[model samples]
Target: MDIKNLSLNPNYNILVTGGAGFIGSNLCEAILKNGNSVRCLDNYATGKPENIAPLLENPSFEFIEGDIRNAEDCLKACKGMDYVLHQAALGSVPRSINDPFTSNEVNVSGFLNMLIAARDAGVKRFVYAASSSTYGDSKNMPKVEDIIGKPLSPYAITKYVNELYADVFAKTYGMETIGLRYFNVFGRKQDPNGAYAAVIPKFVMHLMKHESPTINGDGSFSRDFTYIDNVIEMNVRSITGKNPDAVNTVYNVAYGERTSLNELVELLKEYLGEYDSKISNVEIVYGPERKGDVPHSLASIDKAKSLLGYSPSYDIKRGLKQAVDWYWKNLQ
Candidate 1:
């Protein structure tokens, strides 16, 4: 079966939880671009309709204003869908630290609700957004899927629980599930305004406004910083790749290269400076490290490549350039 056709079939309707969010919107667009039908379910708590505004005109796309925290919403969203991309969650360490209970309700309980609903709906595959934070405190340079460490934050605990629950569902319910453990994803449509905004977008936004961006702890902390396109490719592969050996496994979705904050800032300045010279001199302010923050994260994509034919198309520099260009044109 053609992968694109599989995603679009009326019989294979896809439900993308949090489909209005940055990553989810990108995934939705990709699915639609491939002639697939997609129903986006989002509560708009952290997602913006503007992110998906362009797709509203597409006949293949449907939007449902809903929350994953509600079992009824999940059940309603899962009805007759062939695949479920569970991307909805309360992300960010600080956010979860400040509101652990809300995070648990949305991330843990919400995830379980989706899993059960998808199983009951008899969806062909249940693919959820797992996280690189699951590798917390492992001290491993390139984290592998089989090895993990203690979760550092409530958010981490919730994501780690997704994998655990998925494993259980596969054994108990005989469901086919895959978890994509994303590493520091950044790209177009990423929200840059929130206090909990991710590093790349936040820095890009600050530089665009000619403001200094804060660098938590030292600038030496590094990340894998996988681009959105790479993530989309992984999602499509995970959903359609028919290899029985690759089913029901977790794979790291990343570029497999580490870029430090210092280098990242320099690169961003270089890229954004081409559009405005004033941004080049924007200095970074160092501050106390935030709680539950990891010093470095790099993923081993060997498993994804060998098993799923996964190949990342963008490195940090190229990805940041694309992201910065988008922010400059759209945000400004």
Candidate 2:
């Protein structure tokens, strides 16, 4: 679906926390182009200033360098903002496992700070990034919003807590809140060089350099990899959607199909190979599955479709091809 179809009022003030990160920065760019004033709040804990560097030139864009862990910072960012898209948090399960305290501080406590700030600021709606990890150990094939399993890691716990806090605040204060539970999101501007980089970008980089990409646990694990534009559409709907049923709920933001690790590698190689045929000749390696790894994950985006009118335009192959092209042009 064309993003311009969402059609939020041009003059409304929107605040996107973590607006210097991959998904958040994309949202900022889309919102600004739609003629809205955008305020970006980021401490750069995991976000990059470079992601939003090009965005700084827009007079309608405002950048606030601050941490969400500070309640005062949260309050200042929310003040006068009509809508709040809270995306600031330390992502990655391994990173959370390595440091749970900091993860809890930012994802949990910091989320609370944003909630309070948005509530007090009288923001019309609070749309935040939730996670598929919240499904945890459920073993369900197509994860639905109502059913969930116990959290498997610190990151999962924090994301789940965000849902609970958002629900409570909505009930207690009569605030409008929506959560988008993202599933394996990837696209341009996703950092490919990190100890906890996402598999798609990391593997793309590995193959681009003619290096072997390792698969964890025999390459059978799977995920519902959604594209950035799809995620951007959902965030826009959460703010502009007028349905009362869509408010005060969480919807899975995904393409609704699972791709195995083996298939994922093959697809990336095929797409990247178009740029450098030698990448197709790259070797594959195997390793023991890391801790906190789920065997497979898929989401039921029915709720998003029925309520939020979400229509994801890209599947794995299409999104991967676009991503590979971006990495070749920008990163290589």
Candidate 3:
């Protein structure tokens, strides 16, 4: 998972939109580790300043406080960049359900702004973060790239539109683009507080306080829980990989396995119990099934492997252990 060994251009100047967020900040950190320059653009709407505070003094790191929804800001951020890692978006199914207009504005319209800016700036490649929610109602156990069902939520629709836009930009503008459909990515620096917080980090924070962590369904719902390091490696490969066929296409970024919600809670308890013995006594609550939720989601990463040479370095257990240790050290 060490991206410093990747074949990145030494003189590369990469622009990472939403670079104050979890995955975006990690991309900035990884690129800087490879001795490349990175320009970070974020408005701190969902991204925290503390995430990138330590990187402020690095000579290779540059931060721009801007919003992607503004076309002018997008143009300014895209300036002087060899590559663009576009990760700026408003993410959450329930949040989109409540406010579809804003979701469409940021995820869809804002995405278009970034693409136009990247194309106009003559950026080499555009690597973006797509989501597994695009699979929608597809009952396929392992989701492949070519097959997808109709989108179920505003968030899913926005992501699907992003893929469509990327494809159109590639064909019409001759822009090189890669879309990674991430499957439940989790790890360090992921926000555990928020009304729309992800299940893993929210559950960890709750369990730390010896509180009951709620499961949205009957605990049978499963996900292809990918680790952050694995995600970072795939992104780096998408940019540095020399294969021509890999460009202008989408790939699933996952560990190629699924874990049920019930099993996930148990594993978290086991890991956290070692740090505080009382954590094992915390309970789990089962709530009603949520809207726009699929019963199961597992990704077939064969396309990524065959094309980009993707090899996941961490399974769920190993990743959870690392995350638990990090939370215990930093967030406790």
Please give the CA lDDT of all the candidate structures: 0.90, 0.94, 0.93
Judged by lDDT relative to the true structure, which candidate is superior, 1 or 3?
3
Better of 2 and 3 by lDDT: 2
Q: Highest lDDT, which number? A: 2
For each candidate, give its TM-score against the true structure. 0.96, 0.99, 0.99
Once fitted onto the true fold, the runs of candidate 2 whose alpha carbons sit more than 4 angstroms away are: none
Tens digits of per-residue lDDT for model 2, 82-181:
9999999999999999999999999999999999999999999999999999999998779999999999999999999999999999999999999999
Where is model 1 more than 4 Å wrong at Cα?
A: 1-11
The list of candidate 3 runs beyond 4 A from truth reads none
Span of 10 residues, lowest total lDDT, candidate 1: 1-10
Per-residue lDDT of 35 in model 1:
73
Give candidate 2's error at residue 247 in angstroms: 0.7
